[model samples]
Target: MKPNIYVVPRWSGTIHSDWYDWLAEQVEARWQVPLRRLEMPHWQTPRVEEALAFLSEQVPGLDEGTFFIGHSVGCQSILRFLHQKLTPESTSPNVGGLLFVAGWLEVDEPWDTVEPWLDRGTLDLRSVRERVLHKRVLISDNDPFTSDFARNKYLWETRLGADVTLYSGQRHFNQKTAPEVLSALREMVEPAN
Candidate 1:
């Protein structure tokens, strides 16, 4: 059976209509797999908490072949979830791999859209940096969020040890402007089995 693919967008509840949805559909149709776009509740203080909670519930009783694709803040949420599980000494069976697109792991990133999440004591990036995982990050060389402070380039390199694939001109890899991400995602999922 094909693995379940979950795509987590940057913010919860705000669906920006563009190439992102189209790319996700392409993956489902071409790969013959179940794909879910897990939206965050909203860009608020509780947004990450809610997204993580919703994601945790969905993982129960899952098969051993689910994969996650996260963008921007969504990528950080994925790392948070994995850390929580590891801390508990529990294991998630369904998660097979990850496709983390341009993401900011640093709290001081200069975007107001993500400012509400900053200063939260729960976001421990250093731990995520060192913990090894079987996944990859689709690093955007020109992502604006990758400023020295936000340091996406460093995060992808040191923390993720990512199989970084370069795309020439995309900022943060958001909704409207980016490459056909589904194609890269399919490549990650299909060959693993």
Candidate 2:
């Protein structure tokens, strides 16, 4: 069976914004995979618990046939959801993969709104790393909001065991189309030997 693909959008982002729609189109057209573009609750002012709850309600199942592509804060939601849901006694199979675009461990500005997310203490990635079969992170060198590229890259690599890729001038990856993201998703779905 073709793996189910879920696209989680950025904070303050909609299903139609940026590359979400384009990626969904490409995934359905090329691979014929069932793709879901999640419309997060309170996207403009997202709270971690609410986001996770929304995911729990929206995602029916997770297993080896499940894949996720998350952008910005949506990345945090995905990781947190996995960390919360996947326990030692969990019976579900390992997830297929994850592709995080413009993901961040730290942010640059708008401290007030993001403070809650950042202050939630260290995210335990051990469960997530163990449960996920493959993990990849894509970030921009010049991302305005998530500018600490080196630190973010280090954390994603060391904590989540993700293959980190740095792009030039991608600026939080809010463009209309992201070939890099599409390419990475394809690789995760059909990895080359």
Candidate 3:
């Protein structure tokens, strides 16, 4: 059976399922798999725990074949959920692979209102690194959230053991027509399937 694909949206973004519909179509066409765009409650101003809890409930059977695509704070929430909620002995399933788009461990100034969710102390990168083997981190050179691209790149690549793909003019990758996003996710999920 083809693995299930889950696309997690960025915080405060009104994407819902539209952002990933194109990619889902591509995946369904190629591999006959299904894509689920997870919709969190209070997405406009999401809390870390709330998002994580929602994802946890949705993902009761996360095996090594399950795939994930997380953007911005959605990525942070996924990492936290994997690190805190799932462990070696836990019944919750581990993911097969993950795609992080414009994902960050921290956010910039004036956006600190969401800092409580981005707290570094609560997340564990080691667990994330150990859980998923195929990982891709996509960031834009001009992303407003990630000021230091080099540092963030090194963090995701070296720390999380993910392949970092740098893009230009893709601010937080919030566009409705994101071709690169579709391609990258396809590349990540096709091989594993």
Candidate 4:
């Protein structure tokens, strides 16, 4: 069966915004992949637990054929979910891959909304790494919300063992379309030998 693709939106983000809709269309048309853009609850004032619960309920079958594309805080939600759900004794299957856009370990602004996430500490990379088959992070060189590019890139690389890509000026990546993201998704699903 084709892999199930889930797109987790950013804080205060909508499934209708950015390149989400375009990605869904392209994935279905090109690869026959089923991509579902999840609408996170309480997006304006997001809580980690809430987001995790929502994802658990939404995506109950996180098997080897499952893939995730997360934006900003939604990236955190996906990582945290993996960290929380996967265990050596658990019957849950390992996930296929993860593609995080504008993902971050730390942020420059919006302390009020981001403080809870920052306070949650780092993810259990050992377990998460073992469970996830592929991991990639897409970042912007000039993102206002995430200024410390080097640090963010370092964490995603060293901790999660993810391939980090730095784009020139895709600030926050809230654009109408993202061909780079689509290309990355294609690579993840159809990796080059």
Candidate 5:
């Protein structure tokens, strides 16, 4: 069976799945893999625990064919979900891959709304790395959220074993069309060389 692509959006993200319509359509038209964009509850003031629970409920089970793509805080929530929630067990299935865009481990700029999710003590990158088969992290050079690109790159690549891709001016990537992202998703869903 073709892998299912699950897109988790940024914090305070809307329920409107149209944001990912372009990428979703491209992937579906080419590979026939369906895309399901999850709407985070209480998007105005998001709580990591709540988002995690919601995602857990939405995706009851994951397999080797389940692929995840998360942006910004959505990336943080997804990583935590995989590490803290989906513990290694005989019954739990391994995930195919994970794609994180503008994902950050620590917040340089303090914001009260996002403080709960910034507690890195609660996240276990090692466990997350173990649960997934392949991983990719994307960051832009001028991304406001991630001021220190080197640190972000080192964290995901050196520590978590993800293939990191850097872009020049793609700030936050909140647009409907991202060719690089679309291409990456296409390659990931396709059979490996």
Candidate 6:
């Protein structure tokens, strides 16, 4: 079977730029895989559960060993959602590897991103790390909200046992600047060991 990769962008991003249809239209010509995206708008609602629910619906349809590309706040939501689903008894057959782009492992209350994260409470962080053994945290070396990139990387690596990558001169890893994110997602779609 061909690969099925899900591109989950943050609350602030959109389908056109981050997961541009043009790229999909182009890449599909060669890969023949279904490269698609789902919108997670709970950040505007300021509720993490709503976004998690949206993601949960898709989890069932995804094939085993599916690739999940989560960006910014979507990364946090996916982790929390995964932890909720895969406790001890419950298991999702779809999950394979997690590729978190510009992932926000640390909970911050930025004026825009604060209220929604606060709604989920601090406890969710522990839940996510406890379950998300396979995770990658991509940090921007010059993120505006973060004071120190190394500090954030350390926080995620220590808390979630995440493999952190700090990309220089990038801010938030948004579509405007991070055009290479498409290639990054493609790489993660490789069969996981």
- Give the top-scoring candidate (lDDT): 2
TM-score-based ranking, best first? 2, 4, 5, 3, 6, 1
* lDDT per residue (tens digit) for residues 1-193 in model 6: 5666677777666656554465566458757876667766644544676778888787665334566677776676766777677656555454555777777644444675465553333544554455433566677877776657887888777766777777887777665445466555555555356
lDDT per model vs. reference: 0.61, 0.87, 0.77, 0.86, 0.79, 0.63
User: Please, what are the lDDT tens digits per residue for candidate 3 over residues 34-70?
Assistant: 7777877798888776887888788877777788888
Q: For each candidate, give its TM-score against the true structure.
A: 0.75, 0.95, 0.88, 0.94, 0.91, 0.77
Pick by lDDT: 3 or 5, better one: 5
The CA lDDT at 142 in model 4 is 91
Candidate 3 clashing pairs? none
lDDT of 5 by residue, 37-134 (tens): 88888878888779888998998778888889988888887887887656655357778888888888776696998888874655557766887887
Error of 3 at 146 (Å): 1.2
RMSD of each: 3.8, 1.4, 2.3, 1.4, 1.8, 3.5
Q: Model 1, 1-193: lDDT tens per residue?
A: 7777777777533444345567666766787765677656654433657767977886553333666777777777777776666443445343466788775566434566566444344555443444433467776566665644235555566655666666666656655644547666666666655
Q: Which candidate number has the best TM-score? A: 2
As a whole number from 0 to 100, the lDDT of residue 80 in candidate 2 is 85
lDDT for residue 53 in candidate 4, whole number 0-100 = 92
- Each candidate's number of clashing pairs is 1, 0, 0, 0, 0, 0
Q: Candidate 5, which ten residues in sequence have the lowest lDDT sum? A: 11-20
TM-score of 3: 0.88
Tens-digit lDDT track of model 2 for 1-193: 6889998899899999898888888999988875799999999999988999999999889988789999988888898889877877788779999999999877877567787676234787788899999899999899998678988898889888999999999998989989999899888988888
Task: Order the candidates by lDDT, highest first.
Answer: 2, 4, 5, 3, 6, 1
